[model samples]
Target: MTAPDPAAAAAPSFDIRREVVAVMPHLRAFARFLTGNRERADDLVQDAVVRCLQAAHQFQPGTNFKAWMFTILRNLFYNEGRKNRVKLDPLDEMNAGAHAMPPDQQAGLEFDDFRRAFWHLNEEQREVLILVGASGMSYDEAAAICGVAVGTIKSRVSRARAQLARVMEGGGLGSRTSGNQEMPAEMAAFLAAGTPPKGR
Candidate 1:
């Protein structure tokens, strides 16, 4: 009998890798939205792809590979999120609001302020908001990834927006000044503009 053809054996694997590359733009977008930065997003996507390839056997053929890959990416995000220990820099207490810089300086400070504000949100709320708002995922898809009901996702998104608003306002980075409020109105709209819908 002829020896097994190793090259032939890896052909199927090559096809799977090709499919993954084809979906990379979307995956990168999702990762960037979730992490709120390009470097972290690229790392996340790379990690997800590696994990997916390692667990290729688990994937069922003739099914939705895109969805399957997305599920893997989402799971990895949550797993790492729980382990994230990046500490946020605290504001100076002795010199509260001692900002003496120009408006240009304030602009850069405002970006850092927004980043810190996002870090303050509960993990679940942040995840829901990013998936639904920044990543362009629908409530249903985000809910599935989060393993929660549509209502739960909506609630989380709402609370996230409200919490962000409160944080910005308290930190003197209100919408009128923050320029987009960091949390876009389209994202906050999920909170029904910070109010419940009618008859609720």
Candidate 2:
């Protein structure tokens, strides 16, 4: 028999890398939600991508690649969190340049307030919301990544939404044009985007 083609042998690995790169934005957004620090978030994404590359052989084809990558990222985040508590630097002038927004715009101000409220959420709540509500993962998929039951994921999402509603209604942020009865349209768009909002 002829020797196997080297290019053919490497095809799967190359495809996996391509797919991983395609999802980098989502990974970074998730990392941001987890760390709340831009630099740390980038580091976390880098680590997760490295881990994914090293473990590519274990990834099953036709499975949900996004979910698998997210599991890797969440595992990495928790593992690192256990090793060292992350210290977040304040968003000062030095760092502000990285994510500059027009202060005069109403949408920008509202987004900033929403981000503050989002970060104020407990870790579990934040994770669940980002995974299900923002990242658009189904509850079952999120449950598997989070290592919890589907019901648990659903409950976390429900409570997180209610809490966010309360926060917005109570002026934890500013008044939303969507009114107090529902989540603001901008916040809903942000959650459903499954990636970092613009200027984030």
Best by lDDT: 2
The lDDT for every candidate, in the order shown, is 0.66, 0.75
Summarize candidate 2's per-residue lDDT along 1-200 as a digit string, tens digits: 46566777757654775688788999998888777777878888898999998998898988889899999999988987657746644343123432257765556556665665666677788899999988989999999999999999988888887666556545644443344445557666645543333477
The true-versus-predicted C-alpha distance at residue 148 of model 1, in Å, is 1.8
Tell me the tens digit of each residue's lDDT in model 1 across 1-200. 46656786756654686679777887886665556556666888898999998999888877667667777877888788448723323333212333444545645455455655665666566677767777667888787777889999888888888877566556453333356435445434533455445576
TM-score of each: 0.57, 0.73
Clashes in predicted model 1: 0
The top-ranked prediction according to TM-score is 2
lDDT of 2: 0.75
Task: Score candidate 1 by TM-score against the native.
Answer: 0.57
List clashing residue pairs in candidate 1.
Answer: none
Error in Å for residue 62 of model 2: 0.7
